[model samples]
Target: MKTSESLLAELARSGKPIGVGVIGLGAHGSWAERSHLPALRAVPGYELTALSTSSKQSAERSGQVHGVSRTFGTAAELAACDEVHLVVVAVKVPHHRELVRTALNAGKSVLCEWPLGNGLAEAEDMARQAQSSAVPTAVGLQARSHPALAYARHLVADGYVGEVLSATVVGSGGAWGATVGPRDHYVLDAANGATLLTIPFGHALDGLASVLGEPEELRIRTASRRTSAVDSESGRHVPMTAEDQVVASGRLPGGAVACFHYRGGMSRGTNFRWEINGTEGDLVLTAPIGHPQLSPLALEGGRGTSTGLAPLTVPEHYVRVPELDPRADAPAYAVAHAYQQFLRDLREGTSAVPDFAHGAARHRSISAGADRLAEGGRIVGP
Candidate 1:
């Protein structure tokens, strides 16, 4: 396999935008249309060249709506297209492995959504494939690219909070609550891999781990508070086998105590709140929603002589992409940043963007916690 440096250099020399072919463009109200499409258009050095859907009709319709001419009904055809240098898998988690494998076999770079696969084995399989292919790969753990969180990571690294002592995170899954929509009912099944534990909690955990590092010792508990959820459109009760509440506490590698609690549905008070305390001071991040990758986060800090926490404005340079409407709060803001960083990584031969391997590592961590919960035991490690 050729080195990524050579591949990226060749692509850069082509003097053309990275052609992106997206799979799984839903009929409407899909994440691809709302986030990926907008982010792709806003970011430089990339173009939405092609798209694929479940059927020819939907593919063509989405192509027309999105102003793309190339459309295919299957991921394999899209991946084989010469105009597509990057293949984006935006479908559900169960289909991620197949689509990503198709792209990898076609020798195209891939950007698959988070929870890289349905579970650890699938994630590891794809990660191994990506490594063997030696192609640039990125996973949609976009929360790490959020400007505020990125800046907060820097602050923590720079010792703004001094010696870290502890951290706490509380968030809401928002969708795994008492109600489910017709389109989202699939997430209620743990076998499908898109659950409260994976989607919202997984994204938030990735963001936190990016800043504070991973835990060394961990204990977890999960519960399905609501046995079933009412389908909002059809008014039918959907059996929900997925856990709605997840709690985990552990010690970070740096010796900081960490605690996390995520529950189904939005809370009346705090939807998302994370606090980091140290010997010198404290830092806090708050968001209106639990998905930090989709929602904007506010950062506040108090250090040294400061007695009260004050809003800490992220430096403008942290957001390298062109400004979108509503700025940091825009749905595509963090995604665009992720794309920008990926572009830089390609051009500069850097591996800053979290890749398939990183996704697999995160899956291992989540699986360990889940296994502990399943075994009804605590996990202690160095």
Candidate 2:
């Protein structure tokens, strides 16, 4: 794991591309189909060599449609695939434990989609198995790898925004509200563990932390204002246990007070807005949609003597995957950056990839604060 060169050069030297096996890839429509598959295609050193679904027929159909020659009906079969160097687990939360452990036990590296497991214990178990396997692991927190966030962090560190004073973020949960499709019905139940607070807010938190560092103190308020959602398919209303609105305020590093608010579904007002103010100037990030992980964000800021906030174009060096147009699929673009980083880590033993340990840590942070928020907790210092 010490070789370092261009991806193609490294692949040429090894005489083979990095083989990736994807688990939980559905036959037709899925997040994996829309994001991971395209992300792998945009990346240079990896190929989708194998895929898995709930059944052999499904696996074959998915593999065939995606041009993957190998298909397996179960996680075990895919885990044992000799051609697979990395196992990408794209299944839902409840299934993350078994599939990730199976792949880790098989000695294959893994890239698990975010919220690594259904809960902290599950996430901890996955992280434990990963450590014992001694293989590279990555989580689905793509926001940490976004080029826009990277540029914003550089601006903060390079004195573009002198010692940060305060940061505020207001976001909307585009889908986890009013109603949901049959495929996404599971999210309405908090027990399913992929609610608005965990996925959208969790990713936004990741990006916020990456730019400002972890918070030292926090206050939170959360509520399930919309307790029911209509079933898009059945035309039935389902009771929801998960919170639809989240409000949090905290003191981050550099004594910056961070405030964040998110509500379920799209808002008539701004759907997404994150502002960082400092002694020198202020930076703002926005998008038409609320999910920063899935939507492209444009950066604008104003520094000393600047009349108004002007657009700041992200330069070329930070754009890791030029093949991915931010406008076309921002989520996939961010995902590709993480995938490319994992390939680099696999080659050079770097730690750029946010592994399951990071996943577990985030689970703890998100779950802990969310629990407190649900209880209407007040600000507390670490």
Most accurate candidate by lDDT? 1
Candidate 2, residues 125-239, lDDT tens digits: the string is 8998888777668899988788889999999989998889999999998666777778887887889888887888888988899889987666666776666777778988877
Q: Count residue pairs with overlapping backbones in model 2.
A: 0
Relative to the true structure, candidate 1 has a C-alpha RMSD (angstroms) of 4.3
RMSD to the true structure for each prediction, in A, is: 4.3, 4.6
lDDT of 2 at 201: 85
Give the Å shift of residue 188 in candidate 1: 0.5
Instruction: Indicate the worst ten consecutive residues by lDDT in candidate 1.
Output: 373-382
> Candidate 1: where are CA atoms >4 Å away?
1-5, 12-15, 326-329, 371-382
lDDT of each: 0.86, 0.83
